[model samples]
Target: MGIELELHSERPTWTESEVWHTSRATLLRGSYEHGEALEQLLTRLGRDSPGGLGSVDRVGDTLFDEREAEAALREIPGLLRQCVHESQTVAVHDLATLLASCAATPGSHLWFMGD
Candidate 1:
């Protein structure tokens, strides 16, 4: 029983609220803390989501749409680099790799299924 974030469709097709309204996309699957952090990071970037990343309503909810996902994909690289300076964990490493893959894949939906 852990966090599970997976991009539903290969192409992010929405960017409404980070977690609230996906319309018909895959929701990011993760823990409350992950959503908290995502809210912080995304909010800093001026994204929508007044309520912040919501609790797991469904396993297949998509956090960001195409545009929002693109933005996140761009921002994560810097954060991933920062992980290098901090004390890293296996989880961190795995997440970094996964994010990198998502970043690399043009239409790749990154799902969090690390349980």
Candidate 2:
């Protein structure tokens, strides 16, 4: 079945914005454990996989450097076009902005969590 999804960019975080957690999650369609598809896309692109980002144990250790995060965010639209398109409210641009904000601050990283 071709399920159609509408985007909603402003998704609430599972915890405080800057707080680090044991597992990484994102605000996608469902809730706290949403965004598997998005994660898959990242995996396919070699950015992140099922286990983690491949480069690091992103669960509790992932740290998004401002410069590096910016670079990675730039590639989101093109690299994960399907993910961007599926999100009816959460535009890729918006997500990038959120992630950028997290990256800009101290003790903050790009970890997704929502419920």
Candidate 3:
């Protein structure tokens, strides 16, 4: 459905300095129809950031990045995947929410549709 990126400063809590980017690609395979959604997500992430922590911006094609976004993205997917694989009754909303959170932060990108 959609992916989001969430950033944090220390080990746990996200501060105002953190960024939140998001990308929502098409549900159909191979169609990257959600570019505007991704752009808007990035813009929102930037707006949420505390001044001097750097900027949140969209990158070429399907990439979005922020200074602190990258680190969070690196580990979140694996955790999600693990949850998906390990749990039989995993909540769809929870999974989607996790995906969105993962996609919104830095270094997170969505492969929507066919991608």
Across 4-69, the per-residue lDDT of candidate 2 in tens digits comes to: 111222322445565334132332232222244444444444444332333333233243444545
Q: Rank the candidates by TM-score, best first.
A: 2, 1, 3
lDDT of 3 at 82: 34
Model 1: runs farther than 4 Å from truth? Answer: 5-60, 63-88, 113-115
Cα-based lDDT for every prediction: 0.42, 0.41, 0.32
* TM-scores for every candidate against the unseen true structure: 0.35, 0.43, 0.23
**Arrange candidates by lDDT, highest first: which order?**
1, 2, 3
Instruction: Give the deviation of candidate 1 from the true structure as CA RMSD.
Output: 9.0
Backbone collisions counted per model = 16, 10, 16
Better of 1 and 3 by lDDT: 1
